[model samples]
Target: MKKALILSTLALLISGQVAAKTWVLTDTESNTEQGNWHISSHQLNIKSSPFSIEQTVLHGGKQEGSKLLVIKSQNGLTITLIPTRGMDILRVEGFGVRMGWDSPVKEVVNPAYMNLESRNGLGWLEGFNEMMVRCGYEWTGHPGMADGQLYTLHGKAGNTPASKVEVSVSDSAPYTITVRGLLKESTFKKADLQTQTELQYVPGSSQFSIHDVLTNKGDYDHDYQIIYHSNFGQPILEEGAQFLAPIAQISPFNDYAKKGLSTWQTYAGPTKGFDEMVFNIAPLSGANHQTLAAVVNKAGNKGAAIHFNTTQLPVLTLWKNTDTLKQGYVTGIEPGTSYAYPVSIEREQKRVKQLAPGQSAHFDLTYQLLHSASDVNQIKQDIATIQGDKKVEEISTPMAKE
Candidate 1:
């Protein structure tokens, strides 16, 4: 099956439509294609059609009018982009594997229908179905009353909408598909933040890269925090699945997590009341401070890897929620500047970022979709090289309040 899927990917590369064109899907400033915009291979004007970008709106329920972009690449890769939900990546297909989960919340939900402050600040879970979702601009972590403000689980970023969206293909070889969006978090008399995120991937490759430039549009220097909640489930996560990383320091987020410290790097089958466990890790890196982390299936033949740099995102949070699939069985390989506790604790720990007026922060990360044993094994070897004789610091006690 793996060989056949790989061959199909190669065939897609060999037989794809190549074109150099830019489409303005949505531009609030220029007054361009803004409402329920869509295009197909026929309208794209590309010969033989190696790829196509299409946008459409979902109907009914909480997903009403949710805008989704389905981008198909030349390497037989396809990804669904949600503009209505902070421009998150919904799902991935091809590449000898399927990257998605059976989230009970089946809607590409629009933010208009979600009450982020409901359910005692845990309302973000109402539409939490994406594969990758950014978790902050002001603050993230769990929800709590801190500094006289009620901070919600994660933050407003995932539930926020992008102000603008665009798609373009490279003019030359590689023909990288770039999906760009601008997400803003602002309110009256508060911190005003915006991030221009570009998700780019070559047509014939099994990986994609994210470039984000977050700027404080407000005059005041206010605190901000962001965590990339990259999640996986099903085929890549199961009983006996392994979480691999080059660790510099590791500790449990709470006492419950500490109880499983011995098997922290391992996963289990879904149990009815398993609930969740979280681990905080300071990862080791190679030259240029590059870090890698991944989770492979029980057989170790398939996996997904997150490539990042410690310079921008220095903290890693492993979230194990291997409960029943009906209750959203999944794992989050999160990278952030701070651990997820509460906003007050993050501020006290100095993990929250403060940007000066006109100052911006840059972040770069790549998602490599691994399919075969060779690819998965290669990543394991690369991680081992990064560890390179370093002693890992393991903590037995709880590191923070959860």
Candidate 2:
């Protein structure tokens, strides 16, 4: 029995459960671990079978209304957000990028439709509002996908320079992403994958970390925005899913297609049968920052709160979309620095934030799951607690970038 116990302990150590391990997968291909599912760094090519988390959104942006992540534990507990035929395929397309219900679903403009882009991946990476080539910025898709495609720091790099792989892990288990070679339009020699941006994760939850790693290797200052866009499926939202946000008005894009709902109005209480909603907030100032969240539902209310420090990012945008056309099923809770409208409009409106060269900025946000609540009071209370004493930040720019 002692020998068996020793062997079991050794096995656990080899399997790497003493602490969580962050593996840096590559952007070009999918990585699979035998029995486990296949995953790319971008998280675009999720496995399809064994009832695991399959990619629900398609490359064409066809599946819009439902959640797409499937999570299966080694213990045989199967939980999915909203898995239907509509939610079966992974969408190479993006939310507001192209062919969005807003106006036209232009494939060329769709970064997912493109085989290559600047950044292509998952978990809340922001895309610039505009496409500027001279700025060394080429539209790849969203920063998540665009960055995933153009650059990747995969594999492990030991301390030895000769043995160092493109990717490396310090004594700390954080997976580090490194970029080598000339960046699109900047000039810098070195950059580190910085996930300084963080969100709170449940202690024992299967999904633990939502992180971001940014680096500037350019000569000129990089003025960009990065956001978090989370796609949720069923299992997480049953018949009575609800959402909440501390916003004054919900407005349609001044540029995109007109209003499906309305441009600017009071926050709708509990939107049951709606497609999506968008809100606006200013840059971060004080230590206590403002945020928005999804409230209650039959399954469970899961959402995140966003906080941005101006030195790194200057704006915050809340994007909520449901596939009313699909089956009234899933919703995407995306908190970004910029809106879906054109960057030209944002700069025209003077809403864009600029990041300087070699300078770094940081922020902290939290994503928590909640059960059914009595009313929107819980949300209001949480917001009040988070933003206590700090003044509510508002949009002061309506001027475009020149």
Tens-digit lDDT string for candidate 1 (1-402):
123233333433533455556777777788766566655444645454377778987899888988999888655678888988998999887777767677899988899999889999999999999999999978899999987889999999888878889887755455556788999898999879999988876665677778889999999998889899988998899999999999999998988887888898899898899879999999988877888899999898888888888999999999999999899889999999989989888877778988999899998887878888888888888889888899888899866665
lDDT of each: 0.83, 0.31
Query: Could you tell me the TM-score of candidate 1?
Result: 0.92
Q: In terms of lDDT, which candidate is strongest?
A: 1
TM-score of each: 0.92, 0.46
For 1-402, candidate 2 gives per-residue lDDT tens digits of 122223323432333333332432222234421122233322432122221233233243532322233333222222322221111112212211110122122221222222222233221112111110101121111222122233211110100011011111112122211111111222244322222222212212212222333444445555554444444433343335444444433333332312433322122322456645544544323333434454344433332223333443444444444444343334444455555444444444554555555555443333333322322345546555544566543333332221
For model 1, the superposed segments whose C-alpha errors exceed 4 Å read 1-20, 36-49
The number of clashing residue pairs in each candidate reads 3, 52
